[model samples]
Target: MTAETAPLLELRDVGKDYGSVIALDGISTTVRAGEVTCVLGDNGAGKSTLIKILAGVHRADRGQLLLDGRPADFGSPREALDAGIATVYQDLAMIPLMAIWRNFFLGAEPTRGRGPFRRFDAARAKDVTRRELAAMGIDIRDPDQPVGTLSGGERQSVAIARAVHFGARVLILDEPTSALGVKQAGVVLRYVAQARDRGVGVVLITHNPHHAHPVGDRFLVLNRGRSLGSFPKADVSRDELTRLMAGGAELDQLAHELERPAT
Candidate 1:
């Protein structure tokens, strides 16, 4: 798609309120086809609220959600999935004990035969699972092995590949690298790039600007439930983005406080 075209997913002036508390305030961002939009924020910076709205777990209190330039509202997670929006949370939603093929087609398994003779197509599923994983640049030695046996990064790769195979137009990844070690995080980041290369609009929600900078086309910084700023990669430097995400003023204040002499 051309740059002039509307993004695959766009949130315009989105806001969320819980009683008297505003979880997100006038937040707006876009995830374009073949681009990664990294949402950077520290704890309680409204990242969760924004992801909930995007994943259809919670509807925005106000503002418009547009998919391909048309208005959209998802009443449930199923609706969102049906609309080609897939959310791969950090938890991964996989059965650790289940085999790779089983986990790959867990909820939506393909079956063969009918009339009381229906059975899971284990062979087809395994072959397809293996091929799909390989296509996504994941090298799994065995598709029948338990998911728990796979490393964190490999499991993440499987989740992403599953979403893409299921025809996801927009991928919302919630802190995919948070729980992983440095090397594992790097592995997942490569998969994120792969997803983008496949023309999927990726929404990578994380606190690490360094992780986001390499793969992101645009960065959206949130602080105290409000958007600090959103800028294209070309417009913002890595250091500036890091400082914004780290809350520069707060960090300076803390530094000053620590530097004060003891009473």
Candidate 2:
């Protein structure tokens, strides 16, 4: 691949096992900068396992993880974070009672003073939070507002903007829109596109093909811990993706079996 289109993160035949159970097997995909790579799969499709591996919450039993064309093995979540890989899970890891700026810089808060005089730079944190959110096209009237006051979609967008602000090159979103309404989900997808426009490689994990197809440059479909196949947007239609995610031939057979006998 050319330097412009080279993968920021890549998985080569990656597999993971939990005792006798194989959670993932021979899964391969790539996440290029300024592009969204959607991982579409139904329940029990090993999506969680894959996320854990990518986020360093769990290690792969086999295969390779490449970061910026170099082999990488993240031993823990901190390691992955330090490597510029950030994950925004559904829960978002935010404190509802906390202010927006506080949540934005939770663990990595900015400090202004030194030695015994050291203290959190609340003003700088709030200012930077405001600017970052505005840069991402997220309009928050007040950075002092509690995170609990924002809508589900807004919460998701904040998480995305926070990742971008923290210099995350590879952002992994786990089921970002699964619990949202259609309009709300669209809001999250818009930010996903915005992040792509900003040259971030995004891994969007979702079960919805409709949500995945629109903004995704590539799609990786998984079923029962195995890949159905990986296809570029040019190679796969939304209908086909939906079918694959719904069990493809298995779904067709169920429809056939459920059909009436010439009634």
Candidate 3:
């Protein structure tokens, strides 16, 4: 990874609004290869809005979206995929009854043969899925197992592997650990690191500072549709991050209000 190169994806002064409601305002950040950029904020902090724009679900109203140092405007999620940007939402879009290997390939299946005789290569799919997951430190007992049979963390890892396998240069994870327990969230965070090590620019969107602190290379804090600013890991601490996310004034006031009830 070139430490000084331009970001793989960047949003410059990007923003979105719906009539009178400003969903996101003056947001800017860079996602560089081989690093995790955590977008942290509480509910209603424009996190979802930011994810939508990055995933190409909505166009930015006020700024430029750059890819590889050139301006890029993705018309749809498919266009974003073609541009090597892949998004993994919390729901995961997986079929519970489908085998893990099948879910891994989902819409883009490996195929072989000519014209009408072409068929999905199940063997290659299973083998590649197992190999990739194992490389990410995930050990699956069997590829034929149903996706629903896997734990939350394992499922997230599979989605990530699929993205990386299909040529995604940048990965956007939307609240990957929101519904997970501590142990499971840790598992997902490890894969986030794995993706970084494998040279994928990762955008981790979540409200939990603890989860972000351990794996993030940089932090971008958002609040009520505005960006506080971007901070590198070395520039900020977990407690400071948590306070910013919760609103420093609000936290301080709450702390004082709850202080011993001073009888």
Q: Among these predicted structures, which one has the highest lDDT?
A: 2
| Winner of 1 and 3 under TM-score | 3
Score candidate 3 by TM-score against the native.
0.95
The global Cα lDDT (0 to 1) of model 1 is: 0.92
Runs in model 3 with CA error above 4 Å?
1-3
RMSD (Å) per prediction: 1.8, 1.4, 1.4
lDDT of 3 at 180: 96
Where model 1 places Cα greater than 4 Å from the true spot, the runs are 260-263
Per-candidate Cα lDDT values, in order, are 0.92, 0.93, 0.91
Tens-digit lDDT track for model 1 on 129-185?
999999998999999999999988888899999999998999999999998999999
Error of 1 at 157 (Å): 0.8
Compared with the true structure, model 1 gives a TM-score of 0.95
Error of 1 at 82 (Å): 1.0
